[model samples]
Target: MNKYRITVADKNPLVLSGLETLFKNDDRFILTGTARTGAEFIELAAQNKFDIGVTGWEMPGLDGRAILDAIGEFEYHPKIVIYTGVPNPRIIREAMLNGAAGFYAKGDSTEQLITTVASVAAGQMVFPYFDLKKLQDDPWESLTRRELDLLDYLKTGQSNQQIANYLGLSVNTIKFHLKNLYTKLGVKNRAQAVAVSLSRKSNH
Candidate 1:
């Protein structure tokens, strides 16, 4: 039987070495290649088939999310594991929505890392520090999908015009949604709205 082939990508040399060593000691995983940039990972992924691709959230070029997006468009897409130093719930949710199989924080325990990879490789979702159930129980549950989208765009510091362009809505329509979102979120301004939304999201 063939072992599961894995590719690890990160901008940090130490992290790359550490990951290589960790997988090298694992019997079920074959560490096929390691890359220092998202571009390099994309090139390697295009040239060969991998069962899993582990990448950091932030890198010199392309970033992990962009890499995942590129891979999702390919005919042969491998399961993606986002290994990052940042562990924001919003970012984690975005990764899941973008086709990532799992998420692992860089400071997580070695055992946790091993378990997450194993579970993800077995076709299960793994989120190291997030609780999906709690997120579902947020008080903002009353907010509609469009309201949530508006809030998410607000959190990204997008102006009404930019949000309108991205969501393919007219500026007036976006403004209307923003007003409703602020009312539901009980905030007075964009800064307060974003703060309230993120605070509630983190409590989950």
Candidate 2:
């Protein structure tokens, strides 16, 4: 049988040590490496040395979302399982849409983590329990990163000029992003856009 290659990443020393020990004990996996930060994991990933990457959602530099984004640029993409303490629904949803194979919370049992990693390595998706229908209904899922950033700035009640200056973008560029953002959120204007963003956040 071919053992699966696995890498574990977390900011906490104890968690990293624990996970390393856990995977080391399992006969099904070859513990490739462990990383204390997202950047370290990204470096490990770049080498294409592992088959599955089990990582924390929040890290010192890149974080889970950034890791997902960076993985897109790599030619050899390994499966990713986001193991987070917070387990925010929005982040979970985004991870799913971004091609993450699994999302495991720190609160879950280590045995479950093993099972999730195994399932994902077998080409199955394993994620925390969530409202699938609600996620399907959410317009926030349709927004691109740029449009999402613009929506966040809109939440702060900033003028178009201010946002443009802050982003180092022209007013026309900001307006264009906003127009797309509004359409994604099903809102007609800035006020409605902000309100929709807030409502979705509060629901989560």
The Cα local distance difference test for each model comes to: 0.83, 0.87
Q: Write the per-residue lDDT of candidate 2 for residues 1-204, one digit (tens) a residue.
A: 779999999999999999999999999999998999999999988875788999998888777878888987888878999998988677788888877899999998999999999999999999888886876687675565568778888878899999999878899999998888887777899998888778878998
Model 2 misplaced regions, further than 4 Å: 138-152, 155-180, 188-204
Number of colliding residue pairs in model 2: 0
What does candidate 1 score on TM?
0.66
For all predicted structures, in order, the TM-scores are 0.66, 0.75
Best by lDDT: 2
| Total backbone collisions for each predicted model | 0, 0
Q: Clashes in model 2: which pairs?
A: none
Kindly give the stretch of ten consecutive residues in candidate 1 with the minimal lDDT sum.
136-145
lDDT of 1 by residue, 1-204 (tens): 557899999899998999999998998799989999999999889888899989987877677667888999999879999999988676687688788999999887977888898888888988756777765565474465467767888888989999889878799998898788777667788999888867877997
